[model samples]
Target: MGKARETILEIDLRALEHNYRYLRSKLGPETKFLGVVKAFAYGSDSKRIALKLQDLGIDYLAVAYVKEGVALRNAGVTKPILVLHPQAVNFDQLIEHCLEPSIYSPRILRAFLKTAKKHRQKDYPVHIKFNTGLNRLGFWENDVSHITEEISGGTELRIHSVFSHLAASEDLNEVDFTQKQIETFDKITTQIDHKLGYRPFRHLLNTSGIINYPEAQYDMVRSGIGLYGFGNEAQIDAELKPVATLKTIISQIHRIEPGESVGYNRAFFSNGYRTTATLPLGHADGIGRQYGHGKTYVEVNGQKAFIIGNVCMDMLMIDITGIDCKEGDEVIVFGKNPNADRFAATADTISYELLTGISQRVNRLFIGD
Candidate 1:
């Protein structure tokens, strides 16, 4: 919350707590909450975010890979961690760290069972993933019977929950498709419950799914972007505070005359006298090349300074002709005012890509415990 004297990504833990509490307020008392801390907690520090969520009494945590879960375990995270995409090779390490795996296919299920048995483990919690509509992963509806049959005779693994990914819960235009996916997931769960003669907890909502399709929130809800301060919709965004703010200082200011070019490939030719400010962050720091050429702008001294020319690997220039800013003045790349969603829109991308693309080299400063 202080002025930026150097390039840094400020992580606001209080904002994270606010977002968590806000999302929890939408759920029933019994509904569980799973915080997705994959990709360095959406390009912020995952260990810190996970710890904050843990302190907030989160029911579960999720990561994209086994290594991420192991890292959390190493950092003293004791809450249940679901590895969304556990590989066969790391099944041993996953079990050793007490990380749960989402068994989406027959091959992974079989591999995990073997690994669990080899480790002499019993009743190890594993989630079953159903391919409701997101063709990315998960077993088909017909494969439900196969999953039940395979697990029925084994004690090495236990189906902790059955879950599915919603393809377009954030897009209202895809309501029909999303409803059908929910219906299909319902049928799959019903079949699994019937065949297994018991019920495994079910979950089928992501962040947007929790907001747009609350009816489908079965046993738990998973939130990734929302916890990081984006809600995909303007109204919901207003209720949440962004947890990451990228800030930098003007390294230098330049006065350009007419016909003077700037940056790589002479991307910008000044038509008149203008002033530009260079910041020590660029494509290598996750401000991609597509955001160049005045497509996107950053805030300098509370004024909009459009980016000019191509973004270099470690620096970028912004037009500051009329702005009253100088070297060492704070510049906001994206945060409260513009927010990640609006900033990402200039390049036709989403907040997820921008947030996750931030280079790890950027110094992270935390505010709020």
Candidate 2:
């Protein structure tokens, strides 16, 4: 309820629940829900977030690595978890913890199969990721036959799901590309079904895909940012509530005269007499230097206080001129005043980056049930 640190990321569990319900409202009863708790649950206490979602009865959870999945398991998360990008080295630990992996390449598949066989795993669940267009991960369409053949040899392993990434699902202008991705995923999965003689769970929608292309919602949908209060579109964003608010109090204030400079490298030179506030946040806390030199701002006293000078490792200066604010006043980096989506736009980034960038050292305080 009170801040033990100068800067804190306030997480509203009720807002997160509202977002989950909002997104869930868009899906049918039979459809499954996979809440992505990767990247520290978009940088806001993944264990706590996942625990809440688990209690909410989300069908699955996803993390980017085996370590993250293990963390959830240790935190008492009993729901099925999908490690989106598993490495071969962690296969043993993954299986040890019952963490299913998304095998995208033949090398990974073979390696996992070997590990599973060695462990004498029976019906071990594994998801297959098809490239489809993202080109970041997943197998190509041509890999399906080889995959079916290779996977068929193993009775110990079972294909839990087949999924793909939607490259530009949020960009309506790129609807064609998203459609192509869906089509490719469909074609690849259909071929696999014919060869394997059974259907695995299929999903190919991210937060944006769920909003922009609901028709392509296969057996389930994966949502990361949507759970944290971003819908990738204005209308949809308006319907969701941001769950994390990065707030820091002004540690000190300075009155600079013309010709005086602020911050390291003198990146910001005072044009005239002005007031500035130093915050206990900087690049190390995920507010990169690119946000400096007047590019980004924080909300103070319901006003935009432009960030000035280079963001140091532990501090940044904000021009608080003409604003009624003082030391210890709460300064909103992103949240109620300037929503994370809009705030991130000022830096030519997204809410995901800003939220996940929050330094772990910054304390996190959770509110609501």
Candidate 3:
């Protein structure tokens, strides 16, 4: 490349590994771990993270869609993958990639079974999702009998895992609700396991679940946010490292006069004369327009500079007053000292929202082991 791009995301794979090892340490050897790399590894880079995790010997990998799983497979990841929210249309491709689908509804199960039969796949692996609490995806409790009956009658299909989503595992305040979800999932799994006479891999604990409920950590745990360096529990976060760092370069620097208005809609009117810096990244690059008008900032020479106005489509201006910085100067939007979560905190949001919101146009760079 002629010159390094102004906008880039630095992903720390070492932190990713640290998070994985920390989570893995919490669970017993019997309980396997599945690394969730969906949403481009939570807006980092799934291919890189998945490959690293695979090399580190993660028990399994997971993705939200069939295409996400396919991407991992295309990247030479031979480990088993769970498609968390697989679409009906991609069942064939999922099967082709040797990716397992988490079948929740009877309609989807039937469609996938049909596909397996057409492919002449014997002992085709699948995971059953129960709607213990999330209610977003998974088979309802009432459908347990149907699932068991279907499983018992068929020998071509094999149940690989039975799992449920935690409605709010991170919220300690929702302890009772989370317990109820765990209890409900347990009952469903026991009832189905008894009827079908199959001992499938059982998992319910996510990153939060692993932190708060070691007792509930079943045969395997699926962790998403944990791998990306966020666990709702402060103690857990203390042990985890943030993986994605958002950085940009100053395209230009300018001096503004007192009483001058900046950006569209004149959202920011400076009371004092100040110096400003223009960044080549903006709302289109994942910095929400809401962050404009003094809600966000970039680190300039170890100091924070607030956004001056409404964020534009491709750029934003920051009040770099009193800071010694210029064009080509690096601005740390979120990383290390001034982390992304803290940066997002100014906008009343979380790191997850900001990371997943990172647009594809921004370049991604991976660093360290």
Candidate 4:
């Protein structure tokens, strides 16, 4: 990819393919791979990313909502899509679009069964979520009997898979807790198999789990951050390549004398002669106000320039003293050199928030099909 002529995000399909293959190398030959393309494919172009993943032969794709899945279908994605947090009201639309839902509660399960029966559908694939420890969403282990009873009552729904979330798979200090969660899930699956008289595919690993606990890769593994080139560990990060690179051009340059202030509320006061360059992106573009006042820095002419003053809604200023930069010069917001993870660390944040926080207003330029 070339340097930015304007504020834009460059996505490399080749990097995405590399990350996918790297993750696959850790899985068993028969284990399935599910690529998560939710949150606009982590703030990149979802339609484009989904298409690439489909062409790459991903076994399944996951989105966080029904509308996201529908968008994929509209974009000609034919692979199975799992809506991780579907609402009961959209059950009809979900069925109409052929998107699977992760049923986590009794009310939602009943609502979906009604919709399936209304459509006169048989064996409609549905994923059951058990709350092993995440506590965010899922049915309790004791709900197995309830779920089995509901399934036995009708044939409108079929448990295609059972899955749970990992609360702290990335934190090695939480190994004991994660193990307990895994053990609990195993027991839940056993009960589910006994009660239902059959076994549905089981999965309980996220991106970190895939790296830290490969032994628990049950039947399939879902990867979101890993697919986007972030493994959540320093050693693993070295093996993956970031897929998105945010870049902008220097909109203008300013010279400030000692005691002069810059930006709103005079947030940055110069103690000596200083030079700064402004860029055409700010809080609204996902570089939030939290990054201002020397909290973070951007690369200007291959040199680190710390952000000064308050980050505006559509503009931000970075001190460029001693740097040989001028108007319209290419500035790397975050990319391979610093990477999103390193850039986000300057503000005490993470790559996921930074990547997904990128606004839609920023133009996206794709490389490598």
Candidate 5:
């Protein structure tokens, strides 16, 4: 007997390397690149991606929470890992793992400092985030003085970088807004630097920012989605090679009678004498139930097989009656034959949302040189 082909995401490490090198080349040599590995490397595999990036000489790695940083540490990633949104409770673990926290609000700043003091840490490294129009996180513009004071007076912590996120860096239509964010970030950086009598590595760019706001690339650039081969901008998309591909296999096929309904709630009814193939992957694997009603499809025998009826929790039914494939024939959820982006579009969403939404249960197979 042979191993059963199950739902899987094939990750192309070669493409990942290419994307990293591409983004690195776009930024100035002086500007450092911090690879964002938060959300399990955007729902692919964080530990693997982080290790690869570190091995490829990436300067830093960023995660949305302390636990994410801890995971990378557990995977033996030695490069500097920044917790982009650290909480007070995890401060101890973060420090224990040598993970740097991104100090956003004043409260987090104070909390992290307190934790540092409790641990008897001296000049521990951390980054300061500014609320340059994003207003999602980070200290406001008026808080520059307060931030500078904290850093200058702190005997236990060090500010490695002061950065902000761009809200509309990928939208050329919002040039004015993006430019305003850049100017504001620059102003805040200067004020903090001047008052503290010291300058930190200043960064104000994400993947899109690096391409759309090259002049704003200060001392470092945080590359997240771009490193996974998505630029999110029309121009850069052409240059990116999507690094991940999702796939599955048919577990069974059935011949059905006309008017017979299928799946939970009978969400799908047979139009006529028809055939359906049931796959082992469904909403449980990240293919949402919304994918039913012919809105989404899987490729079988190099042809589209529309998803019929309801997408089940652990199984999805596809109309494979017209396709020439066996019960165990491999079915592509999204890959070379049916691109993930195209499938995501069918779900009225972008590739990022779908890719990042995939459940962690699915296995990831790495393909690289």
Candidate 6:
């Protein structure tokens, strides 16, 4: 007897390690590596990924909110966790879980300082985000003086690091804009340092920044999609192996005659005899409806089988007319052979969206931790 077949996300931790090492090789040993594990470690199991990164000596781990950090803490992750977008409401839990928050606005800074004082904290470490060009969260460059003033008057909080998001680090044509951002971040950090009388750790690079702007590595670097096997560059993507492979089994098969339609809405009509396989996966499992009508495909017996008909809530039909496969044969939605990037491109998306869109219902199987 063998294990029963089912839809699963096979996670190769060895491949993850390879990606990590490859990215690490780009920087000096002294530079800190912050693994971005938000969004359930980019839709892989967060606890599992975080634990492995913790063991791999990742200098820090970051998440989108306080609850994600609390989940990591509950999972026995001892590494420093940074809450990238912490709301004032969760300040209690953030402190309780020993999670650091990135105070982006003056209001957030003041609120967190007040909360720290109420908790009777001393020298609580907090990261500060600046708005160099992203126009998202973070204080503006002009706000630096006010930030310094507020922090100086507070005994409960200390600046742990200063960081800014790059608006277009991955676009080579936007090199001038990227360089200007680097300059702005540098200018802001210098002014803050001069005012505070000491320099905290500084980081202004995301995953692409690490690749496209290596010189701005500064005191730390944050690796997000890059660690998940995407570099947004052909040469780098070739060197990194994708870690998660979405796989499933053929649940059933059907043969349709000419002029016969398939699936709901009769989205696919057979001009001639056609063979199709119904997989036990659909938009609910993160394969969106847009993948229907021969836009996307799955691999069967090493051949690409175009997905025919509409993708349903729990099923999808793929044309397998010339493919040699059985009811129980394995099917690959995305992995090493087809790869996520190529599959995502077919849907006019990116690997980040595809990976993060995977529903939690799909079981994850980890290997080589």
Structure candidate 3, residue pairs in collision: none
Q: Predictions ranked by lDDT, top down?
A: 4, 1, 6, 2, 3, 5
- Alpha-carbon local distance difference test for all models: 0.94, 0.91, 0.87, 0.94, 0.86, 0.92
Off by over 4 Å in 3: 1-5
Candidate 6 vs. true structure, TM-score: 0.98
User: Which digits, one per residue and each the tens of the lDDT, describe model 5 over residues 253-329?
Assistant: 89999999888998888879999999998888888987889888788978889998888889999998778999778
Per-residue alpha-carbon lDDT of model 3 for 1-369, expressed as tens digits?
Answer: 122357998888888888889999999988888999999999988999999999998999999999999999999999999998998899889888899999989999889888988898888988999888786988898898898777667666898889998989889899999999988988988887887776887999988899998999889998998999888766777888999888888998888888888888988887988888888988889888888888777787789898878999999999988888778988888876667677778889988888899999999887886
Q: Model 2 residue 99 lDDT?
A: 99
After best superposition, candidate 6 residue 353: deviation in angstroms?
0.7
Work out the TM-score per prediction. Answer: 0.99, 0.97, 0.96, 0.99, 0.96, 0.98
Could you tell me which residue pairs clash in candidate 4? none
What's the lDDT for candidate 4? Answer: 0.94
Error of 1 at 34 (Å): 0.4
lDDT of 6 by residue, 1-369 (tens): 122288898888898899999999999779999999999998898899999999889999999999999999999999999999999999998998899999999889989998999999999999999999889899998998898888888689899999999999999999999999999998999999999999999998888898889999998999999888999999899989898999999999999999999999999999999998999999999999888899887899899999988899999999999888899998989988788889999889999999999999999988777
Candidate 3 vs candidate 4, lDDT winner: 4
Question: For candidate 3, which ten residues in a row score worst on lDDT?
Answer: 1-10
| TM-score, cand. 5 vs. native | 0.96
- For model 1 the local lDDT of residue 196 reads 86
Quote the positional error of residue 225 for candidate 2 in Å.
0.8
